[model samples]
Target: MDEQQGRARRPGGRSARVRAAVHQAVTELVRERGYGNFAVGDIAARAGVADTSLYRRWGNLQALLSDVLLTRLNAQSPMPDTGSLAGDLRTHAANVAREVTGPDGLALVRLTLALSGEGQQGLQARDELLADRTRQLQAMLDRARGRGEDPPDVLEVLDHLLAPIYMRVLFGAGPLTPDYLDGLVDRLLA
Candidate 1:
Protein backbone atom coordinates (compact mmCIF):
# COMPACT_ATOMS: atom_id res chain seq x y z
CA MET A 1 0.00 0.00 0.00
CA ASP A 2 1.10 3.58 -0.73
CA GLU A 3 1.48 6.36 1.82
CA GLN A 4 -0.89 8.48 -0.29
CA GLN A 5 -3.62 5.95 0.45
CA GLY A 6 -3.10 6.24 4.23
CA ARG A 7 -0.78 3.23 4.19
CA ALA A 8 2.87 3.63 5.12
CA ARG A 9 5.87 1.34 5.11
CA ARG A 10 8.44 1.02 7.85
CA PRO A 11 11.25 -1.02 6.42
CA GLY A 12 13.82 -1.93 9.08
CA GLY A 13 12.15 0.28 11.61
CA ARG A 14 11.37 -0.81 15.17
CA SER A 15 11.56 -4.55 14.55
CA ALA A 16 14.86 -4.31 12.83
CA ARG A 17 16.31 -2.14 15.54
CA VAL A 18 15.17 -4.52 18.23
CA ARG A 19 16.57 -7.49 16.33
CA ALA A 20 19.91 -5.79 15.82
CA ALA A 21 20.11 -4.77 19.43
CA VAL A 22 19.24 -8.25 20.62
CA HIS A 23 21.76 -9.87 18.31
CA GLN A 24 24.46 -7.54 19.50
CA ALA A 25 23.56 -8.19 23.10
CA VAL A 26 23.70 -11.93 22.54
CA THR A 27 27.08 -11.74 20.90
CA GLU A 28 28.53 -9.52 23.57
CA LEU A 29 27.17 -11.66 26.35
CA VAL A 30 28.55 -14.76 24.74
CA ARG A 31 31.93 -13.13 24.51
CA GLU A 32 31.83 -11.88 28.08
CA ARG A 33 30.27 -14.82 29.89
CA GLY A 34 30.22 -17.68 27.42
CA TYR A 35 27.16 -19.76 26.53
CA GLY A 36 24.78 -21.05 29.25
CA ASN A 37 26.06 -18.42 31.64
CA PHE A 38 23.39 -15.83 30.93
CA ALA A 39 19.62 -15.97 31.10
CA VAL A 40 16.74 -14.48 29.09
CA GLY A 41 16.37 -11.59 31.50
CA ASP A 42 20.03 -10.77 31.11
CA ILE A 43 19.65 -10.57 27.36
CA ALA A 44 16.51 -8.49 27.68
CA ALA A 45 18.24 -6.12 30.06
CA ARG A 46 21.25 -5.82 27.82
CA ALA A 47 19.19 -5.39 24.66
CA GLY A 48 16.63 -3.01 26.20
CA VAL A 49 13.79 -5.32 25.24
CA ALA A 50 11.21 -7.02 27.40
CA ASP A 51 11.70 -10.61 28.48
CA THR A 52 8.35 -11.61 27.06
CA SER A 53 9.36 -10.15 23.74
CA LEU A 54 12.34 -12.48 23.61
CA TYR A 55 10.43 -15.54 24.72
CA ARG A 56 7.63 -14.75 22.28
CA ARG A 57 10.07 -14.20 19.45
CA TRP A 58 12.63 -16.95 20.13
CA GLY A 59 10.95 -19.32 22.61
CA ASN A 60 14.15 -19.83 24.65
CA LEU A 61 17.77 -18.85 25.02
CA GLN A 62 19.00 -21.82 23.04
CA ALA A 63 16.84 -20.89 20.09
CA LEU A 64 18.08 -17.32 20.25
CA LEU A 65 21.71 -18.47 20.40
CA SER A 66 21.15 -20.76 17.46
CA ASP A 67 19.70 -17.90 15.46
CA VAL A 68 22.68 -15.71 16.33
CA LEU A 69 25.21 -18.36 15.35
CA LEU A 70 23.41 -19.18 12.13
CA THR A 71 23.19 -15.50 11.27
CA ARG A 72 26.91 -15.06 11.85
CA LEU A 73 27.73 -18.18 9.84
CA ASN A 74 25.67 -17.11 6.83
CA ALA A 75 26.92 -13.55 7.02
CA GLN A 76 30.57 -14.49 7.22
CA SER A 77 31.22 -17.31 4.74
CA PRO A 78 29.53 -16.82 1.42
CA MET A 79 30.39 -19.40 -1.24
CA PRO A 80 32.48 -18.22 -4.18
CA ASP A 81 32.47 -19.11 -7.88
CA THR A 82 35.61 -18.29 -9.86
CA GLY A 83 35.25 -20.29 -13.13
CA SER A 84 37.67 -22.98 -12.09
CA LEU A 85 37.29 -25.41 -9.21
CA ALA A 86 40.69 -24.50 -7.76
CA GLY A 87 39.94 -20.81 -7.82
CA ASP A 88 36.55 -21.37 -6.26
CA LEU A 89 38.00 -23.56 -3.52
CA ARG A 90 40.79 -21.12 -2.74
CA THR A 91 38.42 -18.17 -2.58
CA HIS A 92 36.00 -20.08 -0.37
CA ALA A 93 38.83 -21.17 1.93
CA ALA A 94 40.11 -17.63 2.19
CA ASN A 95 36.65 -16.41 3.08
CA VAL A 96 36.42 -18.99 5.83
CA ALA A 97 39.89 -18.16 7.06
CA ARG A 98 39.04 -14.49 7.33
CA GLU A 99 35.78 -15.25 9.09
CA VAL A 100 37.25 -17.52 11.75
CA THR A 101 40.13 -15.20 12.45
CA GLY A 102 38.01 -12.09 12.77
CA PRO A 103 37.48 -10.37 16.12
CA ASP A 104 34.23 -12.04 17.14
CA GLY A 105 35.16 -15.30 15.42
CA LEU A 106 36.75 -17.16 18.31
CA ALA A 107 33.88 -16.43 20.66
CA LEU A 108 31.45 -17.63 18.03
CA VAL A 109 33.42 -20.82 17.53
CA ARG A 110 33.41 -21.45 21.27
CA LEU A 111 29.69 -20.85 21.41
CA THR A 112 29.01 -23.34 18.64
CA LEU A 113 31.14 -25.95 20.36
CA ALA A 114 29.55 -25.25 23.72
CA LEU A 115 26.04 -25.53 22.33
CA SER A 116 26.57 -28.89 20.67
CA GLY A 117 25.13 -31.08 23.43
CA GLU A 118 23.34 -29.05 26.07
CA GLY A 119 20.01 -30.66 25.32
CA GLN A 120 17.48 -31.31 22.56
CA GLN A 121 17.59 -27.72 21.40
CA GLY A 122 21.37 -27.82 21.22
CA LEU A 123 21.30 -30.92 19.05
CA GLN A 124 18.74 -29.37 16.78
CA ALA A 125 20.84 -26.24 16.48
CA ARG A 126 23.95 -28.23 15.61
CA ASP A 127 22.04 -30.24 13.05
CA GLU A 128 20.62 -27.12 11.45
CA LEU A 129 24.04 -25.46 11.32
CA LEU A 130 25.67 -28.53 9.75
CA ALA A 131 22.80 -28.93 7.29
CA ASP A 132 23.12 -25.34 6.16
CA ARG A 133 26.88 -25.71 5.71
CA THR A 134 26.42 -28.94 3.78
CA ARG A 135 23.91 -27.28 1.49
CA GLN A 136 26.28 -24.42 0.78
CA LEU A 137 29.17 -26.77 -0.01
CA GLN A 138 26.98 -28.93 -2.21
CA ALA A 139 25.79 -25.93 -4.19
CA MET A 140 29.35 -24.74 -4.78
CA LEU A 141 30.54 -28.20 -5.79
CA ASP A 142 27.56 -28.60 -8.10
CA ARG A 143 28.52 -25.37 -9.82
CA ALA A 144 32.04 -26.64 -10.40
CA ARG A 145 30.67 -29.87 -11.83
CA GLY A 146 28.43 -27.88 -14.18
CA ARG A 147 31.56 -26.17 -15.47
CA GLY A 148 32.96 -29.63 -16.42
CA GLU A 149 35.40 -29.56 -13.52
CA ASP A 150 35.92 -32.64 -11.48
CA PRO A 151 35.31 -31.44 -7.94
CA PRO A 152 36.08 -33.57 -4.93
CA ASP A 153 33.23 -34.83 -2.77
CA VAL A 154 31.80 -32.42 -0.19
CA LEU A 155 33.17 -34.58 2.63
CA GLU A 156 36.60 -34.46 1.10
CA VAL A 157 36.44 -30.68 0.96
CA LEU A 158 35.36 -30.62 4.58
CA ASP A 159 38.17 -32.89 5.65
CA HIS A 160 40.92 -31.41 3.54
CA LEU A 161 39.95 -27.75 3.65
CA LEU A 162 37.34 -26.54 6.14
CA ALA A 163 38.20 -28.93 8.94
CA PRO A 164 41.87 -27.93 9.03
CA ILE A 165 41.14 -24.22 9.15
CA TYR A 166 38.59 -24.76 11.89
CA MET A 167 40.99 -26.90 13.86
CA ARG A 168 43.71 -24.29 13.55
CA VAL A 169 41.32 -21.63 14.76
CA LEU A 170 39.93 -23.72 17.58
CA PHE A 171 43.32 -24.74 18.88
CA GLY A 172 45.39 -21.68 18.00
CA ALA A 173 47.54 -23.98 15.94
CA GLY A 174 48.89 -21.31 13.58
CA PRO A 175 47.99 -18.38 11.41
CA LEU A 176 45.84 -19.12 8.36
CA THR A 177 48.38 -17.91 5.87
CA PRO A 178 47.35 -17.57 2.21
CA ASP A 179 49.90 -20.12 1.16
CA TYR A 180 48.54 -22.51 3.80
CA LEU A 181 44.96 -21.95 2.70
CA ASP A 182 45.93 -22.49 -0.92
CA GLY A 183 47.82 -25.61 0.05
CA LEU A 184 44.72 -27.10 1.68
CA VAL A 185 42.71 -26.42 -1.47
CA ASP A 186 45.51 -27.78 -3.60
CA ARG A 187 45.68 -30.97 -1.63
CA LEU A 188 41.93 -31.39 -1.77
CA LEU A 189 41.85 -30.84 -5.54
CA ALA A 190 44.84 -33.10 -6.06
Candidate 2:
Protein backbone atom coordinates (compact mmCIF):
# COMPACT_ATOMS: atom_id res chain seq x y z
CA MET A 1 0.00 0.00 0.00
CA ASP A 2 1.05 3.58 -0.55
CA GLU A 3 1.97 5.64 2.52
CA GLN A 4 -1.45 7.25 2.73
CA GLN A 5 -3.25 3.96 2.09
CA GLY A 6 -1.11 2.23 4.71
CA ARG A 7 -2.15 4.67 7.39
CA ALA A 8 -4.81 3.39 9.77
CA ARG A 9 -8.31 4.80 9.21
CA ARG A 10 -9.84 4.24 12.61
CA PRO A 11 -9.45 2.13 15.72
CA GLY A 12 -11.68 -0.89 16.20
CA GLY A 13 -15.31 -0.63 17.17
CA ARG A 14 -18.62 -1.57 15.62
CA SER A 15 -19.49 2.01 14.70
CA ALA A 16 -15.96 2.74 13.60
CA ARG A 17 -15.90 -0.36 11.45
CA VAL A 18 -19.16 0.61 9.83
CA ARG A 19 -17.95 4.13 9.09
CA ALA A 20 -14.64 2.90 7.76
CA ALA A 21 -16.36 0.41 5.52
CA VAL A 22 -18.75 3.04 4.29
CA HIS A 23 -15.92 5.48 3.57
CA GLN A 24 -14.02 2.83 1.62
CA ALA A 25 -17.10 1.95 -0.34
CA VAL A 26 -17.84 5.54 -1.18
CA THR A 27 -14.31 6.20 -2.41
CA GLU A 28 -14.40 3.07 -4.55
CA LEU A 29 -17.81 3.71 -6.02
CA VAL A 30 -17.07 7.34 -6.72
CA ARG A 31 -13.90 6.32 -8.49
CA GLU A 32 -15.69 3.75 -10.64
CA ARG A 33 -18.82 5.78 -11.31
CA GLY A 34 -18.58 9.54 -11.08
CA TYR A 35 -20.56 11.64 -8.61
CA GLY A 36 -23.98 11.63 -10.32
CA ASN A 37 -24.55 7.88 -10.41
CA PHE A 38 -24.35 5.42 -7.46
CA ALA A 39 -27.22 5.08 -5.03
CA VAL A 40 -27.39 4.56 -1.28
CA GLY A 41 -28.26 0.87 -1.72
CA ASP A 42 -25.07 0.37 -3.68
CA ILE A 43 -23.08 2.02 -0.94
CA ALA A 44 -24.86 0.04 1.74
CA ALA A 45 -24.26 -3.27 0.04
CA ARG A 46 -20.60 -2.44 -0.57
CA ALA A 47 -20.17 -1.18 2.98
CA GLY A 48 -21.70 -4.35 4.44
CA VAL A 49 -24.18 -2.22 6.31
CA ALA A 50 -27.94 -2.08 6.09
CA ASP A 51 -29.67 0.82 4.39
CA THR A 52 -31.17 1.72 7.78
CA SER A 53 -27.72 2.04 9.31
CA LEU A 54 -26.69 4.54 6.68
CA TYR A 55 -29.95 6.43 6.93
CA ARG A 56 -29.88 6.45 10.73
CA ARG A 57 -26.33 7.75 10.94
CA TRP A 58 -25.99 10.04 7.92
CA GLY A 59 -29.57 10.92 6.99
CA ASN A 60 -28.92 10.83 3.25
CA LEU A 61 -26.39 10.13 0.51
CA GLN A 62 -25.41 13.78 0.12
CA ALA A 63 -24.64 14.02 3.81
CA LEU A 64 -22.66 10.79 3.72
CA LEU A 65 -20.71 11.97 0.69
CA SER A 66 -20.01 15.29 2.36
CA ASP A 67 -18.83 13.44 5.42
CA VAL A 68 -16.43 11.44 3.30
CA LEU A 69 -15.11 14.69 1.81
CA LEU A 70 -14.74 16.23 5.24
CA THR A 71 -12.80 13.21 6.36
CA ARG A 72 -10.40 13.52 3.41
CA LEU A 73 -10.04 17.28 3.09
CA ASN A 74 -9.69 17.96 6.80
CA ALA A 75 -6.55 15.90 7.08
CA GLN A 76 -3.71 17.92 8.65
CA SER A 77 -1.00 18.80 6.19
CA PRO A 78 2.15 20.60 7.24
CA MET A 79 2.09 24.26 6.26
CA PRO A 80 4.53 25.17 3.54
CA ASP A 81 7.57 26.77 5.17
CA THR A 82 9.97 27.19 2.29
CA GLY A 83 11.50 30.46 3.52
CA SER A 84 10.28 32.81 0.78
CA LEU A 85 6.56 33.42 0.41
CA ALA A 86 6.74 32.76 -3.33
CA GLY A 87 8.24 29.33 -2.86
CA ASP A 88 5.71 28.53 -0.18
CA LEU A 89 2.83 29.63 -2.39
CA ARG A 90 4.15 27.58 -5.26
CA THR A 91 4.28 24.58 -3.00
CA HIS A 92 0.79 25.26 -1.75
CA ALA A 93 -0.59 25.73 -5.27
CA ALA A 94 0.97 22.50 -6.45
CA ASN A 95 -0.50 20.64 -3.52
CA VAL A 96 -3.90 22.22 -4.01
CA ALA A 97 -3.91 21.43 -7.74
CA ARG A 98 -2.96 17.83 -7.07
CA GLU A 99 -5.70 17.37 -4.50
CA VAL A 100 -8.31 19.23 -6.53
CA THR A 101 -7.61 17.44 -9.79
CA GLY A 102 -6.95 13.94 -8.56
CA PRO A 103 -9.58 11.45 -9.69
CA ASP A 104 -11.24 10.81 -6.34
CA GLY A 105 -10.83 14.40 -5.25
CA LEU A 106 -12.47 15.71 -8.40
CA ALA A 107 -15.26 13.20 -7.93
CA LEU A 108 -15.85 14.51 -4.44
CA VAL A 109 -15.99 18.07 -5.72
CA ARG A 110 -18.49 17.04 -8.38
CA LEU A 111 -20.60 15.29 -5.80
CA THR A 112 -20.48 18.23 -3.43
CA LEU A 113 -21.53 20.66 -6.16
CA ALA A 114 -24.46 18.47 -7.16
CA LEU A 115 -25.71 18.31 -3.58
CA SER A 116 -24.55 21.69 -2.26
CA GLY A 117 -27.99 23.30 -2.70
CA GLU A 118 -28.81 26.98 -3.23
CA GLY A 119 -28.27 28.98 -0.05
CA GLN A 120 -26.48 28.90 3.28
CA GLN A 121 -29.40 27.07 4.92
CA GLY A 122 -29.41 24.55 2.13
CA LEU A 123 -25.69 23.78 2.04
CA GLN A 124 -24.93 23.68 5.72
CA ALA A 125 -22.47 20.82 5.43
CA ARG A 126 -20.76 22.41 2.47
CA ASP A 127 -20.59 25.68 4.37
CA GLU A 128 -18.85 23.95 7.22
CA LEU A 129 -16.30 22.63 4.75
CA LEU A 130 -15.84 26.11 3.25
CA ALA A 131 -15.21 27.47 6.71
CA ASP A 132 -12.57 24.86 7.34
CA ARG A 133 -10.86 25.66 4.04
CA THR A 134 -11.06 29.38 4.78
CA ARG A 135 -9.32 28.88 8.08
CA GLN A 136 -6.58 26.81 6.50
CA LEU A 137 -6.01 29.40 3.77
CA GLN A 138 -5.93 32.15 6.39
CA ALA A 139 -3.30 30.24 8.29
CA MET A 140 -1.11 30.04 5.20
CA LEU A 141 -1.35 33.79 4.65
CA ASP A 142 -0.75 34.43 8.34
CA ARG A 143 2.43 32.41 8.15
CA ALA A 144 3.59 34.56 5.26
CA ARG A 145 2.89 37.73 7.24
CA GLY A 146 4.72 36.28 10.22
CA ARG A 147 7.79 35.92 8.02
CA GLY A 148 7.53 39.67 7.15
CA GLU A 149 5.94 39.27 3.73
CA ASP A 150 3.16 41.73 2.96
CA PRO A 151 0.68 39.17 1.81
CA PRO A 152 -2.25 40.40 -0.24
CA ASP A 153 -5.84 40.02 0.84
CA VAL A 154 -6.70 36.42 1.55
CA LEU A 155 -10.06 36.62 -0.15
CA GLU A 156 -8.49 38.14 -3.22
CA VAL A 157 -6.05 35.29 -3.40
CA LEU A 158 -8.95 32.89 -3.16
CA ASP A 159 -10.86 34.71 -5.82
CA HIS A 160 -7.96 34.88 -8.20
CA LEU A 161 -6.33 31.51 -7.73
CA LEU A 162 -8.67 29.13 -5.98
CA ALA A 163 -11.91 29.90 -7.80
CA PRO A 164 -10.36 29.80 -11.24
CA ILE A 165 -8.59 26.52 -10.56
CA TYR A 166 -11.80 25.02 -9.26
CA MET A 167 -13.63 26.26 -12.33
CA ARG A 168 -11.07 24.60 -14.53
CA VAL A 169 -11.34 21.38 -12.58
CA LEU A 170 -15.12 21.33 -12.69
CA PHE A 171 -15.56 22.68 -16.19
CA GLY A 172 -12.47 21.28 -17.91
CA ALA A 173 -11.69 24.63 -19.48
CA GLY A 174 -8.01 23.82 -19.71
CA PRO A 175 -5.31 21.43 -18.59
CA LEU A 176 -3.81 21.73 -15.11
CA THR A 177 -0.37 21.72 -16.62
CA PRO A 178 2.85 22.62 -14.81
CA ASP A 179 3.00 25.91 -16.66
CA TYR A 180 -0.49 26.81 -15.62
CA LEU A 181 0.23 25.98 -11.99
CA ASP A 182 3.44 28.00 -11.98
CA GLY A 183 1.77 30.91 -13.71
CA LEU A 184 -0.95 31.00 -11.08
CA VAL A 185 1.58 30.99 -8.27
CA ASP A 186 3.64 33.70 -9.92
CA ARG A 187 0.68 35.93 -10.72
CA LEU A 188 -0.79 35.57 -7.26
CA LEU A 189 2.50 36.34 -5.53
CA ALA A 190 3.17 39.26 -7.87
lDDT of 1 by residue, 1-190 (tens): 1231121124457766777889999988988987888998999999999999888777777777877787777777778877888988999999888988888766556766777758787777767677877898899899989989899999999888988998999889999999999989888877
Model 1 ranges off by over 4 Å: 1-10
> How high is each candidate's TM-score?
0.86, 0.74
Displacement of residue 104 (Cα, Å) in model 1 is: 2.8
lDDT of all predictions, in order shown? 0.81, 0.74
Q: Compare the candidates by TM-score and give the number of the best one.
A: 1
Please tell me which predicted candidate would have the highest lDDT against the true structure: 1
